[model samples]
Target: MSLGGETAKATIAKFAMAAVGFFGSILFARELGPKAFGGYYLLFSVTKLADRPLMGWATASKKQFADNETKRRELVGAQFLFNAVWILIATAIGLLLADRFRSYSGIAMAPFLFVVLLVSESNYEAFDRVLTASGRVGLSTWTDALRSYLTLPLQVFFVFVLTGYAADGMVYGLVGATVFTFPVIFYYIGTRPAVPSVDTFFSLAQYARYSIPTDFFATLYNRLDVILLGMLLLPAAAANYEIAAQLTAPATFVATLAGSGLMPRVSRLRAEGKTVGQEVTNTIAFSSIFAVPIFFGALAIPRALVVTVYGPEYTLGVSLLAGIADTVYFRRRQRH
Candidate 1:
């Protein structure tokens, strides 16, 4: 497929995934109610917050893979080691403080869930970066789509249909979805080799010099509000903020798909003595096709969109949604 076609495919798949997430969010909100669901959202958000550094490693891995296909295994192995260390350390800490964390977030099975979440998230993030860098854009998007769409059905079965606990249900569903999608990822990347050498680790870590701070700030910027609202305000407030964020996810996903497709092509173009500046220009133009409409639409009908999609209690976040769209717009415009 052409780049435009690929972008559209990824974007449409992401929109479908977002719809699945939207539905799941509604179920979570309605079934658990705002307070409990807020606590659960906070728990998950904090887990993602902690994983930012590891996620930076994954982002760096993408760039490294794009830059040098020969180093794919070494890059994958190094990141595997990075995530393994993080998983072990985080699990230990979460186990020791599980009760305290659970009390604060009202998330059940906190320690066990954290371990599972970290493992699943690490695998998914690593898989995504590798897929995108390898130029398997379709597969990359599909893996993410599988996780997003499959989790909702599994959660529904466990959370409401089978009368299981909502938090456990969501966590289990996430694990299951990631596991279900793992074989394709594993097939693509193959197994991690033996533990890489110290030199290999450092080389991989070097790439993260750029990714680390960027990922950290981006993760914190995205989640700090949710975290603060959960901690300092009501859980319902946190839930509302999450709803607003989710509402803006498509625009962000568009930029992500474009960037993911762009980098490898950019690297390849440069190698072929082609003008990468033109490619970057083309990508921004393509992404803006979606970004511009979404931004203006959000500004025009934020309340209608929020209320119609997420129900009335969330209408208070319409302004937040508009602000998020503005952020999305500026970020896309400034992206290289």
Candidate 2:
């Protein structure tokens, strides 16, 4: 598909996912209240940090898969092996450190649930990257949408309908959604793993050498604040901060979606010996159109938007919205 077509589908999928996520966040916040929700967010942030180590492999896989069609299956096999080993090692370490994680996050299920979350998140990310790298951008977007849509109802059932799960219910729902969606993702990708050669491992590792540090610092930059808040302050503070961050997330979607579609296109264009200067310029220009307005809009109504969307219980985060919005805007610009 053309970049425009892929971007349009991604935009639509993002709209749907954002709408679902907006409602779901409200429900989760109201239902669990600030303290519980904060703990959940903290646990999630920790898992995101844990997952970062594997991100280099996923990043390398995307570039390699896009550029080297002949080696796609071997790349897939290598990535799968690498991810499996990482998950096993990470999960074991997490289980061994369960007590510390539990004490810090104040979530009783942190130890057990963290492993499930890590596995699910790792696999889902790998599958999504494969789809995008293979130029199934629209399909990949819908696949993500599928997971988001599935997660909400399951979360509602686990958190609201069932008894005693509480914030842990959110984790359960997410894992369930991932389990249900994997087969669909597998079917679409349609490539069985081949035996990866020694060179496949070397190539992936060489690329990951650069990608790992980039992924590591980026994940830390994004999640470190939440992690620090969870450690140093009340869970409610972390919860409030997370709510503000979530509310401002949409501001960067245009740039994020553009980049998603741009990468594969650029890879192909470069392979074809075509100049991509105009394409990059046009994408950056197009992204600024929405990002700038969202930044200002957030600045204009930070207080009202917070109390209205997330309830007065979250009013403490009102001061945070504009700053987060500005960060989102700058991050989008920096990304381009």
Candidate 3:
């Protein structure tokens, strides 16, 4: 497929993921109720934060795979090694601070759950980025789509059938979905593991220098509010905030697709010694057309939307939805 076709496929997949996630959020809220859903949201947010280091390596690996196809296997194996080691360190830290994490997050299982969910999510991300960067975007998209679409049903089974533990059930569903989708990533990574060398470490270090801090602050910027809300307020408040944040996902998903879809194209333009300013301009202008409607719609429709989708109790989050709606632009700007 051509670039436009690939991008359209990714964009469609992202939107489908968003739609599935939005419905899942509603089901979670309805089934778990506010307090339990809030705890689950906290679990989700913290795991998201825990993904930073893995995200950094994944971002670097994506660039390496896109830029150096011959080295892709080595790059993939080295990254796999790095993440395995990092997970061990994180596991030790979680064990040592298990009690503290329980006290802080108010979830007795926070430390254990965090480690399990983080490892699963981190591995999924590492593989996803490599596939995307390697131009197997359709495969990558389907992997993500499977995970996204499966979460709701899996959570229903776990939460309602197997366990009454709402938050834990959700975490279980997430981990399972990720694991179920791994074979696709594994197949694309191919048959052999590339042995890591001093050169592999050096390359990873060079890219990490640029990607780590970028990922760190980006994760914090996106997740800090929910973390703080969890700490400072009742679980209901955090759940409300989660609802608001999720409602803007259509906007967020579109913004992400715009960025990810255009990165290689932009990089290619740069490599060909072609001026990219016009390309950037065209990207921003095209994105703004869709972005404007989503942003303003979120701002204006939050109350009705919350009531319609999540019921009236969630209506309290209307302001929060409108406030963070502009984050779509922030997501877009970072791609530049």
Q: Highest TM-score among the candidates is held by which one?
A: 2
lDDT of each residue in 1-336, candidate 1, tens digit only: 356667778887888888888888877876776667777788788788778788888887777777776667777778778888888888888888888777767776777787888888777776677777766776778778987878888888888877857777888888888888877777876646456668767877887887888888888887887888877877788777778777777777766787778877777778778887766776767766666788888899988888887778776678788888898788877874
lDDT by residue (tens digit), candidate 3, 1-336:
244456567778887888888878888898887778888777777777777788888888877777776787788788889899888987887789888667655677888888988899889887787777755665678678988888778888898898666788888898888888887788876735688678877988898888888998988887888888878877788888889878776665544654664665666667678876765565565464465677889877778888788887787787787777777755655554
lDDT: worst 10-residue window of model 1: 188-197
Clashes of each: 0, 0, 0
RMSD of 3: 2.3
Question: lDDT for each of the candidates?
Answer: 0.78, 0.85, 0.77
Estimated TM-score for each candidate? 0.89, 0.96, 0.91
Positional deviation of 117 in candidate 3, in angstroms?
A: 0.4
Task: Give a tens-digit lDDT track for model 2, residues 222-245.
Answer: 888899898788788899998998
Superposed model 3: Cα runs more than 4 Å off: 272-279, 326-336
TM-score of 2: 0.96
| Backbone clash tally (model 1) | 0
lDDT of 3 at 5: 56
